[model samples]
Target: MNDKQVMVKMVFDRWYALLKNCDTLLNSLTDEQLLREIAPGKNRGIYLLGHLIAVHDDMLPILGLGDKQHAELFEMFLKSPDSKSTEGIPSVGELRSHWSKQNVMLKEKFDGLTADDWFGKHNSVSAEDFIKEPHRNKLNIILTRTTHLAYHHGQLMLIKQ
Candidate 1:
């Protein structure tokens, strides 16, 4: 392979690593702890888990993997009055299953893309409202999203620590 192939492989690898780290972090918390609100004003693990899933679910349409049927599910999360309401928060097992399924779906989407597809322009209206970036070459966007997730995950972990 050439430089481009190498770069894409690296991006995919890094994405996998990030996702694994996210899963590990989430798995570390007990069900009760996952539901506990660590800080008075902070979101609990359940809220963060739901938010992460919602974000990924929102990305599905932008990635062209499916229709926008789940868009409202994520929208509800972003527009919800309180993150701690537990109205839509899944159980720990349910969250774990959801995470696994979404992870697989995202990986499939990434793997199915051609070199040009990664750099092509795609419009994504997820929790962030509006986002447009090169779909074929999305290393920067992946890094940015991963960083955001890590930051929030760190905050959640610190609260428990």
Candidate 2:
């Protein structure tokens, strides 16, 4: 395969694997379990899940995929610190549904990109800069988000016990 094709495959594989692992861990939890905090003041499982959903939803714009599908999520999850407030934040079931839909939409958009588009400019990278540093292309976003997922996935594990 060409370099762009290979890069896309690798990035997608790793991203999918990490997402699956996170989903499995998340699905195993009860709604009440998701509300429990990892520590006294730290984020709860539900909060983290909403944060992840909002972050991933934002990725649509950041990756030049499209406008965000859930703009309200940014305020509810990203704009504030972890809250048990539940005033605006979605419930566990709602967040789970949002998470699934956002990911599926992301995957669909990702699949539509041409091989060359993978090496094209992303959110911040200028055309010149992208050519100079191809590693900063769209695929790198997946790598960055993969690490982010792993970080929160570790936190999600703490809610289990």
Candidate 3:
């Protein structure tokens, strides 16, 4: 592989590591633990999990995969207030199922992208603009989302504090 391809592979490996760490953190929690808040007024573990799933669901179409498996998630997890304000967020089990399904599918789709595709424009960038700045690519999207996941991982830890 060339230098760019090697770098891209490193990024992908790092993303997968972050993802695995998140899965490990979540799996280590009990159902009741998943409902605990980071702080008295902060979001719950389940709420954060749902929010992560919702954002990653969005990455589907943006990455040229397919539509969101749970479009309804936007309202509950993305747009709505935290678990403190939301009235009827899905149960922990349901959200866990969605998280598992959506992530598995996303990984499958992401794995299908060629090395060149990683350096190509994601849906967010127009073709003309991408041509002018090829650095704004799908790999950048993964980098952004990895940071997002790690941020939430920290919050997840606070539930136990």
Candidate 4:
């Protein structure tokens, strides 16, 4: 494989692996377990899952994939941290479905991109700005989001115990 192919593969592999690990841990937990905070005053497992879904959903637009499918989730998950108010949050089942759908959709969109496409600027950057900062490409988004996934995944582990 060429350099671009090799680089994309490496990042993609890490992303998929981290996602799978997160999914396994998430699936193993009950809704009650997820509702508890990873630590007092910190985010809960359910909140983290919803936050991840919203963040990944937003990546669709940022990566030039498509419009977000779960923008409504940003209110409870992204715009705010965990709280006593569980007002309009979706059920754990719904959140799980959303998470699954997001990953499948993302994988399909990501698979469509060629190595050259991976090197192209994501929607977040201007053409001129991208030229000045070539490192901020589609692959970099996956890399950064993967790290984000790993961070939350680690937090989710606290619930598993």
Q: Over the stretch 1-161, how does candidate 4's per-residue lDDT look in tens digits?
A: 99989988998989999989988998899989988889888888889989999999989999888899998998889998687456778988899999998889899999999999999999999999999999989889988998999988888998778
Q: Which candidate ranks first by lDDT, i.e. highest?
A: 4
Better of 1 and 3 by lDDT: 3
- Write candidate 1's Cα lDDT for 53-147 as tens digits: 77777666666668643454565455563467667555767776887887887787778877656655455434343334223334445656677
Stretches off by above 4 angstroms in model 3 are: none
lDDT of 3 by residue, 91-139 (tens): 8889888888877788889889888889888999999999999888999
Give the poorly placed runs of model 2, Cα more than 4 Å off: none
Ranking by TM-score: 4, 3, 2, 1
TM-score, every prediction: 0.79, 0.92, 0.93, 0.97
Measured with C-alpha atoms, the lDDT of residue 98 in candidate 2 is 88
lDDT tens digits, residues 1-161, model 2? 98778878888888999989988998899999999998788999889999899888887887888898889888878888986776667888998898888888888998898878876778977888878888897777778889999999999999999
Which pairs in model 3 have colliding backbones?
A: none
How many clashes (backbone atoms < 3 Å, residues ≥3 apart in a chain or on different chains) does model 2 have?
0
What TM-score should be assigned to candidate 2? 0.92
Indicate the residue-level lDDT of 110 in model 1. 76
All models: lDDT?
Answer: 0.67, 0.86, 0.86, 0.89
